[model samples]
Target: MDTRRILRRTRTGACLLAAVALLTSGCSFGSTTRPVGSAAAAAEEVPALTPLPRSTPAALEPYYEQKPAWRDCGAPGFQCATLKAPLDYAEPSAGDVRLAVARKKATGPGKRLGSLLVNPGGPGGSAIGYLQAYAGVGYPAGVRARYDMVAVDPRGVARSEPVECLDGPAMDAYTRTDVTPDDAGEIDTLVAAYKKFAEGCGADAPKLLRHVSTVEAARDMDIVRAALGDWKLHYVGASYGTFLGATYAGLFPHRAGRLVLDGAVDPSLPARRLNLEQTAGFDTAFTAFAKDCVRQSDCPLGGRGTTPAQVGERLKAFFAGLDTRPVPTGDADGRNLTESLATMGVIAALYDESAWQQLREALTAAMREKDGAGLLVLADGYYERGAGADFSNLMFANAAVNCLDLPPAFDSPDEVRRALPDFRKASPVFGEGLAWASLNCAYWPVRATGEAQRIEAKGAAPIVVVGTTRDPATPYRWAEALAGQLSSARLLTYEGDGHTAYGRGSDCIDSAINAYLLDGTPPTDGKRCS
Candidate 1:
């Protein structure tokens, strides 16, 4: 599945919901009452535990024993370091991959709680970027005061040995290629784009690409934990990071500490099912957006009382018109808004309700004023397109990690064609494009090394799994499924809209998670917050 930001920033930060066909990192709660009375009392009742004995293989002891000589990085109050991990765990003699790590020391009033690693998802999203932009500065003061905030860009991601694919111009072309093909020629162009992207990645880093799977990334986390002098890992992972966190817990159950998996992905799903479910999730989010849009004076969808399906029809018709007649976007690169870009523009805003007004204005500009600049901006944000030709390795790493984690969702156009009806049923507006998007991995250079399986993490400490009832990138069902699979997990529900719940103005979620991070107490399982 595609994964990126749990909390996307844009220009200063980046995107949230992964594009359909691309898996993304993206979570909810509300009663203000602290679950177990006071934080002080809860802190006093810290859980007793026996530390897990280090089981580092003799071949890999060097990596675990190494210490990072932290130094000042560009971002204030943050120290940066490079971590080394085995390129191939199966053969430690093989070269090494250097991971970029950053941290902000605890601002203490209470006893320090060791390092608390945070990953904002993106099978491709840069963990270091998330730490510096949001998690490091924006986390609750109580939690930040006690725990050293840390982040490591995963292998094949930004700051690490990033996996490069297409250059800026080529990537721009790829994004514009039509997904809803009307003819064989259009289909051929779409397929050619995917093949070129996969081929470019293989040519750039054949060896590195093979080793950037989730399993390897999880293993890297353990090495980081060891190097940081932490006995156990305390982490907050959102979106695809949830999958990574679950994988880590399963692999090193005893090393698992207080892990918060927000906007979780279900480890039990195959690639195709994951894509299908996410498409439906986008539709759910759009329905909510549409309902709200109709009540606004500037809404482009319709007047008050317009059914969501009717709004969707208007949008689909607009997209159809764009397929033949693209609109001017006033981009310096001369890039016009195509059907594909417009779709991405709309989807990006669905990640959080705060973006709805921006989307309304964007839609109004595009549909009513015939100016596509606003929608183009939204699309650019989703793709992490920066000034001129500059772009992050997010899409490249997104594809690399996703293609390796599970087999391709569809092997050929015929397979996707056959699956179209089910996908359309799941989401009439987004299904067709998303179904076509799922065909991306079919052109991967390397063979798949992993498969869909449940993560039990049997010996791990209590883990918290948070879900938003209407998260577009990661559906709520995924959280439920993951919680049921993990041996020691408590599912926290947010009856709300958006990609994730915590730190996005949810006091209940923040307090519960904060209490768990500071003390050893977890919210009661199945707690619902609104």
Candidate 2:
């Protein structure tokens, strides 16, 4: 079992796919000391939410009615604006959350369609960043000609009063936390790390932390829609963005015009079930990587005759070797490549097949040459820790939203201990740590505001849900589940590797999506792309 990509959905920002590598497996390290008592509590499950109406709440009317004042920002063609949304939806007057918005007008040859909002799916990911960086410039020219490409930095994300937990050095320490604790002392260290992380977030963004839930973010999107003067939402959301898009559709079905939820998440799953399934998905990806790795002459995992199991064993052995003695990397910061960092680097490579060659090369250097710099670089990329030691708000906001979305996956170390075998059953390479990683939210200062529920979004227009058969992060089955859960969803299958399918060299996927977005023609149900 490999739980390398446990919280893959939340590791998004900039080009979601580029950040994909940095979304490396989530874990923090420990000092190998025991605590007086276990830092665990009973899991709290929120009652499932019924769909909210499209009608804006009276208190929120001001937010939805306000027009944005757009100005030239970033690139010459791009414009940026600030929009306001209620910090707390239920009690709208409590406060306000400001969102950053960006758009590029249609370069039209013909008719203009409505505004098209795009989110790349880090609950932490910056949607406005995505629009300015890629979708605004790279989407099909015809689609761009018709639609004003738009995005909003949902509350608590970058340039939107972004959440901050740990500073760079502290985050470096946090990422090194021992996820796979071998003893009570290790467990205590892990608990301390989680406490430190949760406390940092609480101290840094007390008010905004509780206000950044996905439900609120979706509502913020609606406000952005109205501010942009779009009658309905024309949107494309990838990875966790799919969850936000689905939440929008589920909440405001009539306003859900045309949407593409790529690399979908199953809203029906419990946090634990979701984590376990994701662990298995990573294992599936590692198995694929291993099978592919052995076929290459320079693969460090195994030779051509080796089986995937053998390769995994060899890799596991390598990891065990590093657990005690971290390999030295040429990092000026003196950051040696620990087992956690190296494993994260490997997980980063699993997101894209194109990176497999690089992984092989990195592994060769780490295993044969005793040089850990390449893997350390990959690990840094995954964490979004820049060469200058500056950190993005990505992971901070990722933890904030995910912790609020569902109850902690594991309430206690005992609970994790009980679920350990099953997690390992899901992924031998990365299982135990992920099972422990799920305990992260247990120490969250804010109680969870949401829970598992089926989102049929009944009465919504046809929504296209794209699934890649071998997507490592958002698994293929999640897309299937999401499509089935949405009343008018049309499933488009890409039987391939990597994360999301569209715009990643799959013409079939791109064409189908383009047709839906442009002509309102959904691809055939269960349409398959190679």
Candidate 3:
């Protein structure tokens, strides 16, 4: 529901962990109007960064000088280690949080280029998992031959001191809880679910919850950078990871080096506006899917010549039917394909066009055959639901980090009610449900510690910002905005679909990014690749 779900998967062929992304929560800001400049043009007025001193603070020098005790883990070539950082950075003597890090040494015949740290977004995504599963072995051979691929699971993420919330059954029930309420009673039910989830997280990790903010995570990255023996940071961050990378650059501009932010998030927008725009972005992606679906003979929504609007109406009607008579998914847990789960299924596939065919088949089965298993599978995959009734710490950490990063998108149901019209205008099909979903953070136990602000990272070396034309999770304008905001950023446009561009099928996008990582050369500003 924090809809920052970006780069949940590896490549097109691999199963992606659904990145729950960021959704902030807590106290309200009354009478505060949505920030203007929702457009890219307005975001171009870059802010000047006030960076931290080049010299490490005396109290934090130890953390920056700690050595990683790497041992073989995961795949054959990969190694894992734990890096320690203070629980409360401002009070280093208070306590410490150990972070999990992984890396694969460069397999080179050429001179090694230090390390290349990578993160696959999800304030909650497992960076170590991503490194072993994808980046460690899937990167360009030349790049892989030259740089040690690295990753760190930020505090409160997997392998790190993770934030624990609901158990498997509890999470299943929470996911099934109706997001689109038709009556007051249902709305209260949804509200109660959110409260219960937040409470569970608070009850589970009271202290860690308060310390998992993005700012803290960025600080953790810097410690890792220093421990790796690198003089500067070379990184690749996608989706919410982009925000992390930018924050790093802003905080340590002098140490920033060859950063690639693909599928960027705009750090300038408030939660409400981000939710609204993301709702619109889903519409944009669905429209593309609908247009393609109508051409396929197996399409369940509609046939050729049918407008995307009509396709949406049909899908909406189907959802309405499921609101009452939920279809059977034959899930081992006996969960049915409720409207909420069904919607997540559709949303998951939209992240990658390669999944569109699977979505169509799932929709056809759910709509025509009255079988909900396929859609259920998609939803399960999105949530990273294991066959054994287990779940990763992803959702819990997602909420923990998100709630600490910004103010709640909506403080109350009444606020959501008031904003429904604008949300619906953004996407007729996803508007109602997503608007309700955005309310999850209102009950967050931790009050937000950060706010929307531009990151200029001035004095940093060239940072490449890449955006897909129709990126459903983080929009292209966000890349444009981020590029415009960062003093040394180069905007590389991928005229394609899906979430992030690099390491996908585009030789152009891949080559450009590969070159940047290998040679410290960035693509020209505003360079376009199909």
Clash tally, candidates in order: 20, 15, 3
TM-score of each prediction: 0.92, 0.91, 0.93
**Highest TM-score scorer:** 3
Candidate ordering by TM-score (highest first): 3, 1, 2
- Each prediction's Cα lDDT score? 0.82, 0.78, 0.82
**Cα error, candidate 3, residue 358 (Å):** 0.3
RMSD of each: 6.8, 7.8, 5.4
lDDT tens readout by residue for model 2, 476-497: 7777767767889898888878
What is candidate 3's lDDT per residue for 182-240, written digit by digit as tens?
Answer: 99999999889888988999999999899998888988999999999999999999888
Residue 65's lDDT within candidate 2 is: 90
